[model samples]
Target: MTTPTAKRWEIVDLIANRTVTAGEYKPSIKDYLSELTVKPLTGIPVALAVLYAFWSIFSSFAGALVTDGFMVKLFDNYWLPWIQNVWPNPDSVLYFLFVGDPLADNCFEAFGMLTSGLFVSIGVVLPAIFIFYLMMTILEDSGYLPRLAVLMDGLFHKIGLHGYAIVPAILGLGCNVPAVTATRNLETKKQRFIMMVLLAVFIPCGAQLGIMLDVIPETVGWVMLYLIIGFCLFGFILGKLIPGGNPEILIDIPPYRRPALQNICKKLWVKTKGFFINAIPFVLLGILFVNVLYLLGVIQALADLFAPLFVTWFGVPKETVGPLIAAFLRKDLAVAQLSTIAMTPYQMITAVVLISIYFPCVATFVVMLKEGVKELAAAVGVLAVIVFLYGGLIHLIGILLGVA
Candidate 1:
């Protein structure tokens, strides 16, 4: 037995019938990797590099290649044409529902279930979702997420959130529904609400980001930059307004291990299936809503009603009213619809930014309500103010930069 001592070391006497000698243990490769990847100063740059690589691969390579080169072209050249051919009558209600106008160059302009819905849901967004989740799952399993969170703890504390809040924020990039639910891990309602607000206002879900990549590839980085700046700025401001003390982060940093391929695939499948099941139905419903509203001529009416706010203030076209209405159902679908309009990259960016901040999808809204009605109401008020002010602010920025 060793006795307590004031010094760092205490020696214990060992008694055994037979003497035994053991070889010394040597450090493994993971031990060396951690020194660079998880240490304080080096960890930050390495994390940024990993993130940059992730964005480049997911957005520029896989998303562009699989979505634009293969899926969109497949739908435009074969699937959409076949549907249009089968239902040649443009005036038929069935044709309107499934095919929209047969004369449109591609499914994007067609705005129907078989056309726009299929293209946006399966063709444009699905591939990106697949790739994004694949990478996310890999990171999650490899145990690097906590180290990255630690690197971000100082910055997060400045905004009244501890490092652990990064989990929900990262999850928000995949989908806000789960992200909102993940907030339960937070200690206080104020922290949860603040996190929820920041997610709803700034983080672009994978599907929405996919459409943005397809439509505004050249400036997607700039769009993300603007959103991140807004996220940090608003988070700090909201922290000051909301009453909450940020608790210090206490987290376990797991040892890094090689991620198994089977596990990654299974996790990807579960997440992708959830997204497909929830999001695809809403996309089809969005197409139906658009067709019915356009048929009733109510779309134009609503466009007129909101013309001053959307058209004049936001500097986007009146035609965006349909997409804005559709945003409540599925934001990615709304972003897809915006791509069909003949707007400059700046106008498109303005609409994208507004939709990002305006409100969560209907499912997320219900979750917020369940969390607390009063809190939800206050969140709504904050959303509205930010949407209008930021919407106008981005437009002014566009003009100054001459992109609008």
Candidate 2:
């Protein structure tokens, strides 16, 4: 009969079967995995709840700072001077009205969205996302994210999706491009498609939502709430419609701990850098594109091309054409430009919602191409068309219901 010590040695030897480690420090896979379980899970949803509250408060303060202070000055002092340097007629109403239009100003300062709206829009939005990501990363590293997946599984399963889709939902709050790109983590094609299209359609990014609240007032809050409800309902319906295999989840959950400061900064740098590098150029280029389009009268061409739909079908002003085109580049910027226009609360609500899911930003677009599902590209086009159509529909429906 083997002694107790011999039994321990045998277990060690069995664990070390794959290695040649003198059979001393080896252990079974069960033992190794058990080491991970020793740390108690204070749970995931609680951490997420904490994080949501943090972002909401901080983001509003940042948006207010930029809108009232930095934004006001950048336009008044710097942008005005730069425009004057080019047009020599900086004080003109047209110059003030369409701050980025190149007519009475050099194209440099005429980029209204990048200059005027950037601070309040991006400065506020990015920080909020950063705080959110920071909390998410801590939760993730601490093993809360996996447990979160488990906790959410029952509800998510009813929607025909695995709970892992929560990762993209978090990302979608930051931006859809990264969220779509993240679908790579999902095992099946169907999970990826449902997550991608649903995320693209329903989720409003941190920046757009922040600015919408800042610019539109209390009623926009109602629109925002309605849109969120719309997202959940549609997301559930799409998940049911999409067919997919659910892979069994097996994740290593680490004990919760302080995320290293270096890691948070690195994450912040990578994400924010990626965001701006994609954003700034597109914003400038969109303004440039508009400048050229206006120069060549292509905008007029498109407006004339679709005049009936612009005036009759959508119930928005014809001038909204420029902002709509600009949205393909950056939705927040396009929405900012829309603030300069005179429209009713209903029109504003409809326009904002339309642009909310209008399309992924340029950075996100590249991610879509890279993720490379044949259906997703088509989904992008479909979502864009739906954004406008749905926006109009929502407005019409709300009016009929007396909510509008």
- Most accurate candidate by lDDT: 1
RMSD of 2: 6.7
TM-score each candidate: 0.90, 0.76
lDDT of 2: 0.65
- Pairs that clash in candidate 2: 100-110
Best by TM-score: 1
- What TM-score should be assigned to candidate 2? 0.76
lDDT of 2 by residue, 1-404 (tens): 98999999999988788576453777766455334333334434454565566566545554555544565556556765564566546555445434554442322234554445455435445555555566666666655566566556665666566767777877777777778877778778877777777777777776676667666765566666657776666667666666666665555555545568788778878877876776656655666566567767887888777677756666666777777787777776677667877887777777777667667666666777776757756777668666666766776775787745
Model 1 lDDT tens row, 1-404? 54466232422223332355677978888888777776768988898899988888888655768987788789888988788777766789888878887788788888888798988888877887888888889889998988888888888888888888888988888888888888888887778888988888898888888888887777677778879988888889888989867888888888998899999988998999998888889888888887888889898999999999887789999899888888888888888777778887778778788778877988688878888899889989998988888888888888898877
Candidate 1: which stretches are off by over 4 Å?
A: 1-28
